[model samples]
Target: MPNPCFSPALAIPAMMAALLCISTGARAELGGTMSSEANSIAAAPQTLLNGALRLRTVTDAGNTTINEYATNTGQIIAYTWQGPTMPDLRALLGRYAGSYLTGAAALAPDGNLHASRVARPDVIVESGGPMRGYAGRAWLPAALPPGVTASDFH
Candidate 1:
């Protein structure tokens, strides 16, 4: 007798669904606490910045190295990334993803499809890269620690 519950046709879809659930659930959004996702990402030991901030670095499955800067109290304030592919902006941007998408959409095409810059009073994101190389940064202006600037992230 064959196993009715084990159809090959259903296997791929089940596996894909499982992967989607795992990826989405494992992300830690910007402007949020980092403990949960940090723990899962094989994070390096947190580094302190003059006692005012902390930096946590992690490399995702795509080999993108992401550096997340946070307040001493654990709120993520900025992120920088570089790798062969771009990281998931929606996951990294958290609540600001909509703003980024909107701002990007409003820009006139500059003939560069792979590059975008979104600047708002509360948030800023800039990214660009070629076929096999990518780099970018996103940050919250008000949340940045005193004496810390956007250039300090990369």
Candidate 2:
């Protein structure tokens, strides 16, 4: 029997509380000891963090932010880094891509995750660290406008 006094506001909070309780009890079954880094990474947005997208990034003098966006599950939206020069962005992402995920994951340096996106790897970015306000090189895809090109697609 449905409660006559139930409201959307009440239902939402109650449902959330129930879900939380269920998940908390199930953690042991999932099987893993918690670590500070793992917790942070898990808690941090898989798509966004502190106003920055996960994979897209822009850097200043002391910090860099990598951000990427997603909707529902599929159809990804990319991020853009503001660069003083195209080459600078390219160099940043070039090093970043080549050194970070690819080296560890051993994947290709595939920049510009989207059809309209552009990225380069300039430095080896650590997977776990203090994010945001970090300076980084710019990233503008493999086929940048005018004179820029990937050069080595081998």
Candidate 3:
């Protein structure tokens, strides 16, 4: 913005304030509450499953929303409220639901969802890859408890 009428310094600040206002406005729409409190409590369902496969922020910074939820059934679900019915991901991840999982996940350099196993970080790949990584959300090998048929859910 090198206009004779506009100052670059002023432009930058104005842009920043506008961004802040928009960011805060989005939060206000979410009831003006930071996820810090809700996230931990909300993540409990995953913890109780395997304790090992738990929700993790994609990275420590630059990410404001929760990004991933690893389940007891060796599946990693991404969390992004971008597309239609992304809110359904929560119900799909319900305690009784160990099947469907689709949130927002970026593809890696390999064009695959970044998935990780328990006790592993940044090492996300299955020897055979995603089970049925298509449709509304992807489904992994749902490790149903003994005597429980996988067909029961469908």
How does each model score on lDDT? 0.68, 0.25, 0.26
lDDT of 1 at 22: 42
**Could you tell me the TM-score of candidate 2?**
0.19
What is the Å distance of residue 25 in model 2 from its true position?
35
Candidate 3 global lDDT: 0.26
Query: How do the predictions measure up, each by TM-score?
Result: 0.78, 0.19, 0.20
Query: Which residue pairs does candidate 3 place in steric collision?
Result: 115-124
Order of all candidates by TM-score, from best down to worst? Answer: 1, 3, 2
Model 1: lDDT to the true structure: 0.68
Output the lDDT of residue 36, model 2: 17
Residue range 48-93, candidate 1, lDDT tens digits: 6676777888887788888888887788898888998667777788
Mind giving the per-residue lDDT tens digits that candidate 3 earns over 1-154?
0112211121222222322343211121110122322342243233433353434332212222333444444354322221211123223233312111111122112322322211112121111112222112212333324433212221
True-vs-predicted CA distance for residue 40, candidate 1, Å: 3.8
